[model samples]
Target chain A: MHPAPSVIIFTALSGLGFGLMAWLGFGLPAVSGWSAFTFFFVAYALAVGGLVASTFHLGNPKRAIKAFSQWRSSWLSREGVLAIVSLLVIAVYAIGVIFLNQRWQIAGWAGALLSLGTVFTTSMIYAQMKTVPRWNTPLTPVLFFLYALAGGALLAGQTGAAIMLLIVLCSVQVLAWVLGENSFARAGHTIETATGLGNLGRVRLLESPHSGPNYLLKEMVYIVGRKHAHKLRVIAIFLMGLVPVAILTLLPTNHYMAAIAVLSHMAGLFVSRWLFFAQAEHVVGLYYDKR
Target chain B: MTSLPQSTQKKLGLAIDLDTCVGCHACVISCKEWNTSNYGSPLSDMDAYGAEPSGTFLNRIHTYEAKTLERAAQVVHFPKSCLHCEDAPCVTVCPTGASYKRSEDGIVLVNEDDCMGCGLCAWACPYGAREMDVAEGVMKKCTLCVDRIYNENIPEEDRVPSCVRTCPAGARHFGDFADPDSNVSILSAERGGFALMAEQGTNPVNRYLPPRPKADISGSGQIGVPATALGEETGGAKGFLSWLDKALEKI
Candidate 1:
């Protein structure tokens, strides 16, 4: 909930990178030589850069390699594994397309599916968090997938795909916002439920356990200013969805407009992602009446 | 393995009696004193003596006012730590397999050596029980005093967790909940000990005893009439002179 800049960067950049790779795997831009090499280079740099950025937030980044071992149960591990697998597959596909001048349809399809799957796994890393009710919903994955696909389409200069995805993702983003707002407003747990004291008519926080902030308080009790959050959400929606759609529709296929759309959507999504973490209300926070 | 066992051999946990707890915070201090030195990290403090002190700890006592009626209110001090759940999200959500629940004793523990302290397990915990030690760069939590509970170096009688040992009101309990005959199991059955945040489906092993009915605080201790009133002889006295005389004589 602290909205660590590294995590924000990782999610935004990687989603776009993977999105582009998925499209590129399909041979969408249909190019070769230096042109194809540049595309592949940009995709790999973003995807890998985002992955590496994630480790910077870890308490011990040197041991991050160990995270790959727990894929059986952990979504976070699944995400790590999937990201690596996708990256590797994308690498092979990139080589085939650039060097061999071969689409290798099956490998392309495989890479595309895996790239999408990696993004899905990454979404689940947050979506599976039952503690944060705002994140523990199907809409979270939907919102993420839409962002990836839409962001990717825009980067590849696929005007039709970008416009279509932008339309759908904008609607989904609205729904996500609505659901997120209602998550805490209509949460099942309260101070009484949190404390296992439902029999008590009404429970209220009288005194906090500690005089100073502790780990839980710092990490879990993140409270964003309501008015500020509202203003930011409006800004995010306008920048990420509305403006991009407007730009793509108005300009149709202008190179500069496409670039503008990509950058605007990225900035917008970053702000929204920040709010996603900042606004998340962990059920445990109910005990502290944070919700 | 990160995957959970089908069933654990034991479910060791604590049952705190909210009824008798006087909120002395003895358990809090004792836990810190024992765990800071014995556990993985020293529970480092940042600006401990400054204007804003902060630190890491596994257990915390939350105080609340339960108002049954406008005039009837009870103060509740809740002591919370990891429940070591049967379906612990913390254990399953761990990326590095550092967080695990033991199949033998059911004590949730952090293998600090393997932990990268990504804090994802902490994010998954609905109880807010997991703590990240800033100094060690690893997650820490209530091991149920695993190091002391089974340590042969310690006296047999002192084998319980520190919080249970130092609870001044004897409100904190530690035992094998898997045993139907254990004190915690019996207490849970008798007093209707309930799990915290049951809807979360963690199936918490730890429980809290509901607040028992309190005796009426009104009427019972009030005196109807004073048997030896000093003012009896000065009832007809005028002004403050006689009233002061009667009060002084009584004193």
Candidate 2:
């Protein structure tokens, strides 16, 4: 599939934003009163901003409300509805934190659940496309959830508990990346079948339908050389996974280094997300005459 | 609220035979000829004389080799257009409701005037069947020659799609698939027709019959006749006769 930059940015940023929300909402109530307020405000802002950025993906942004009507069958609809619901829950939680002193605890718990729901919904948007076997696996949603939590924990206030959370999150991220890579390899066979070939044997392009380029070729046939893809994969695993974990575990307990690790993780995730789209060969790619 | 009876409905579809298909691409040409003049506006060719000339084609022939080992393999020509899937992802994803499936005949169609050219329907489709009409600012696809198929002025037997009629090898067949006794349904069953990308669960109405097997072309390795078959050389006369026989054998 051709990587839509808007969508790539949306998914990656939302994973971070929602992941941060999940960790903060779940952890804030345990923290001291003043510290809880500060964490909640920052996490909520990220989540809301990420959700707003996602709206730019729609071709006709005004008709986005229609997306909610097909939630019964369409994952995209469910995602939109769930995002709205999560936003509403966060709003109520913020109100409770500011004024509704009696319901603060109850609202915080709701906020935590809503944050997790947002992550699941976001993951399901890709996970439901069974045609793309790489995205269809149960691991896809699990990885998204893990990535969100990891990103969130990394961004949360740099306390001792926060450092421990970051370490655990990074471990899960590495595990998910390994599993995701395997899933992609398996998916290659299915994509070969989708092109009307009878077997998994090598299928090379002999001709292209268009002269210069067409929309289908531009969108589906994203060419990432094997060597470059390997290099990027290693960088993603190290910077996003190992480096963050190592900094949290081995480095001196300094807030600046922890924050820098978080920034590096985000940067690594941007590259990883680009690979995620670039490496995905849509079945339509077969028609473009370039394997 | 009122509901329509299901028994009155029909499922129309096309049955394509891969075995007899000659790969002449006549169906594609006929489809372009019919749809361009009849359906809506002409499928304009941007520049016939210029460096880049492009136009809308409702149908196209995609030739491929199915599991071959030879250098010049046997090719399977797939005449592709809209499958007019029962699920019709393109219809459901249309934000404007301009694209829809006919409840009566199961024909998926686009309303050119109502389309806003959002291109979401094209993205939703896995088959890449839909294409944007740049001149009209709307999406277009195979209508199954709706204008020609139902024309009252034409004779009943001749009222089928132009592609079906123009197919020289009789590879294309069109009919109502809802009826069990329909020609398309029967042919599909007998031939064990397969849907492209069945894993996608699009439930495409059009089906492609598998190509029939051909004889093996591998050569067998063997030597010439034995040396003992040659007569013995006794003397000058006999040797001369043997030489003569050898020359006759060579001839």
TM-score for chain B considered on its own, for each of the candidates = 0.85, 0.82
Q: Number of clashes in every candidate structure?
A: 0, 3
Which residue pairs come into collision in candidate 2?
A2-A219, A19-A148, A20-A152
Specify the highest-lDDT model's number.
Answer: 1
TM-score evaluated only on chain B, model 1 = 0.85
The DockQ assigned to candidate 2 is: 0.19
Each candidate's DockQ = 0.67, 0.19
Summarize candidate 2's per-residue lDDT along A1-291 as a digit string, tens digits. Answer: 666777777788877777766665564445544555666676666666676766665434565555566555555556667777766776676665555543455655676677788789778766655444556678778778777877787777444554565556556655655665666446554434555546423444443334444445555566745348778877876778767777877888687887788878888887778876776655555554443
lDDT of each: 0.85, 0.67
Tell me the docking grade of candidate 1: medium
Question: Pairs clashing in candidate 1?
Answer: none
